[model samples]
Target: MSNRVLMKGNEIIGEAAIRAGCKLFFGYPITPSTEIIEYLAKNLPKAGGTVLQAEDEIGAINMCYGAACTGTRVMTASSSPGISLKQEGISYCAAAELPVVLVNVNRTGPGLGGLGPTQSDYFQSTKGGGHGDYRLIVLAPSKAQELYDFTLEAFDLAEKYRNPVLILTDGFLGQMMEPVELKEKPTSPEVDKSWVVDGARGREKRIIASYSLTNEIGEANNLRWEAKFNGIKEKEQRWEEFYADDAEYLLVSYGTTGRISKSVVLNARKKGIKLGLIRPITLWPFPEKAFIPYKNKIKGIVTVELNTGQMIEDVKLAMDCCVPIYLYRRQGGMLPTETEILEFLEKQFKLSTEEV
Candidate 1:
């Protein structure tokens, strides 16, 4: 029988990680994403895994770094503020080429933002959360099923690339409930300790350092990292598109906002609005090809974001302003409801009647 079950988004993330062969979870409790840690705390032990609640987000991510150095499948999750605290560790993870998974159930940012859904961290996550020439393999999930699937995918991508993979979500997606079918549990691959410091048996001590003193050596390392990122872009870009057959307008969004935008598109379709949606599953890669076909047909594009405006910039760059791209966003922890989006579309379409 399929392991299909109704679960909260956060719970599904933790459970799916276990099924994906994640054995170590280190995190501190935070709003929206705290359930992930709670779930792992109870279930990881039952699964013969380990879960540690560190003193703070910094400590939590550092613990993750330590566990990852031993070739353990490690993960850490937090909301916006906590994620900010973990940026230093994230940068270190990137520079050291450590395979790790990070989940950010984002809320409003730039300070002690409210514990409400917001996609304000788009730039922070996609452009690398900390200082350094690096990129996180960022995945954005619009539904609970995508959350579960992407958690598993994140583990594999992290190991395959030897880089950190971030599941960038929002508070709404994290707190929502939905039915999800857990994929078959992945077999844990035997750890290759050739590079890891696993007890240092019959091998020289391994160093997992991010710093290179020489400028030339650091530049060489950075170039190697860029080549890896290019490889990832060639192999890992992912996106979903719909209704471009004769669409005049395309909506670009991700995570919870993307799901809501899709609902708006469907509802507008019944009302004869020829609109389409491009959901970028991998936010960092930006799914540059997802909009190429619609470039000619797209008279205008609407970008719906939970933040004031972030991913819209990427959409604009991708489209090169060939089409009139409009931004519809709500910030300060407010969600853009379907009616609000439809109303915006009505204004854009210049509908004379109230049919919209």
Candidate 2:
């Protein structure tokens, strides 16, 4: 027996947040991600939780910052444009070392692109969305099941690291519906609350600020944050490999695009193409080690992305561009179908064959 149900990706995120012990949610509605706010508004109160529809994305994130600093589990969600507006607040949360969860249901965009699914936010998310020497724990879930499971884990990771955690999904996964098992809500890891601002009733006054006027103090704070990031990089890299055991070519992708590329790998294998897929679950840590083993073994690597080639830069850094590395991309919310991806791979194969 299981508590399985069919749910849209965005709605599942809402439900998972509640089950993850999130007590407060503040967000401004945006395409593809609006369902999360709507679902939470309707359901969270039933479970003694609170949801607020803020005036704007900026307002919503500042609200999140306030709630999180009080030691309450809090989250906020938005799309690319809205996420841009929230960066300043996100930086504040990071500098203050507040544990918060931010969900971005990415849509195509440089500015006001359609509501179509896109992964163009990779740079914004993984490279520290705000201005600072900080990093976020980014989780990319391709399916509804991973959306639910990762949301459950995100809260704990945020608390454990005392940093903001981001659940990065795109319009495709945000709108699609699938059957998923709703597991029992896991308890968040217990952390010291002595630093929280709760009126300072019985202890010394506590302050949470992202400002360090003096150069010496600023350097010290940044050094400590860098140490934490190094620890996370070592321990939190996560990824999935399919058909890579004897693969001669590797395709790197993440989120919904990763699943599509997996299908391409399967079809290519049937035609004796020897293609493999490496789907990253954690984007910030970037799963650099995942490429190390295949570096010498593979003849070439191709990175297929929803954006022009955001993650490919990280791929190049990971593999040092050892073998021939190619980029196959479609932007502005266009998805790359299996046939198109296969054709691209075939073109590369033909070129290699000619060279040989």
Candidate 3:
């Protein structure tokens, strides 16, 4: 097959999952993200994979969890409301240490939102959306190409950590069409499946569940998982930076907003206002180190988001400073244009707004 093709973002993500050796997929149909399930249903079977249109979001996620427990690569995708419905299943996957790929094409709001792109789910996906002290590896892709590339990366990260991984995309990326360079079919690794359930045919039986009767045992399990997360945080942080080495002002963002912020940085630089951008590819083990070198040099920082100010808090926490952090956001499916973002930056940094 050719390496490059023009396709919808959601469809490309489905193809990327298949190429990543994902053989089992379970998802409920949801707007803006339905194309992914639709594509997988039509194509996965031909690739020797199974696609099940589960009864609901919960059923789909649980099915994914089961497949992951058997050491089979599995995936599920949904929009904002549907993802909320799958939260309990997601937490179960975390507790059971199942490696599953969960994708969320976010739309608007707290409930029954419209099919417009939004990043309001930032807090939900990154900061222990489900109950218990758990974390999911989160990836935010800005373009259709990253959407395709990140889907493949998500499976690898999931198995590497033996935990659920999330591709926190938005409706704009899901619905937009672009040319993407498809990855070559991945070669499966020599993975050890001895830990998986194989019906106890001669070997000892394997047990997997998230329940514990006593507090001591539960605390032990939690501590073990916490150690794994700390290791992951040390090894798996990924991000992108432009003009940050010497900038006086910095902009932090992810997903579509990050892409827009890049352009804003270029324009601001042309106007003689030294600006830089930090786009986090991994949201959970956030690219905290990306800010360390610039922490002392930057005069101020701005966070641009599709939501009001969810990610700004993380920026503050990561930088751990009181250096005049500001937020420019648009919610309820609205995206910030270059002019709006630049104007906000100029106003916050006290720069002249004219022609900048």
- The residue-by-residue lDDT of candidate 3 on 158-177, one tens digit each, is 88788999999988999999
Question: Which of the two candidates, 1 or 2, achieves a greater TM-score against the reference?
Answer: 2
Query: Which numbered prediction scores highest in lDDT against the true structure?
Result: 2
How do the candidates rank by lDDT, highest first?
Answer: 2, 3, 1
Error of 2 at 229 (Å): 0.4
Q: Determine which window of 10 residues in candidate 3 has minimal summed lDDT.
A: 185-194
Off by over 4 Å in 3: 185-189, 353-356
- Angstrom error of the Cα, residue 74, model 1: value is 0.5
> Alpha-carbon error at 255 in model 2, in Å?
0.6
Report lDDT (Cα) of residue 58, candidate 1.
95
lDDT of 3: 0.91
For model 1, the superposed segments whose C-alpha errors exceed 4 Å read 186-193, 349-356
Worst 10 residues of 1 by lDDT: 185-194
Arrange candidates by TM-score, descending. Answer: 2, 3, 1
Local error of candidate 3 at residue 81 (angstroms): 0.7
* Per-residue alpha-carbon lDDT of candidate 1 for residues 1-356, written as tens digits (9 for 90 to 100): 78889999999999999888789999999897999999999999888899989999999999989988888899999999999999999999999889999999998878988878899999999998798879999999999899998998788888888899999998788888899998785664554446777776776777889887999998999999999999998888899887756887888888888888888888778888888889899998889888788777778988999887889889988898898888999987888888899889779867544555
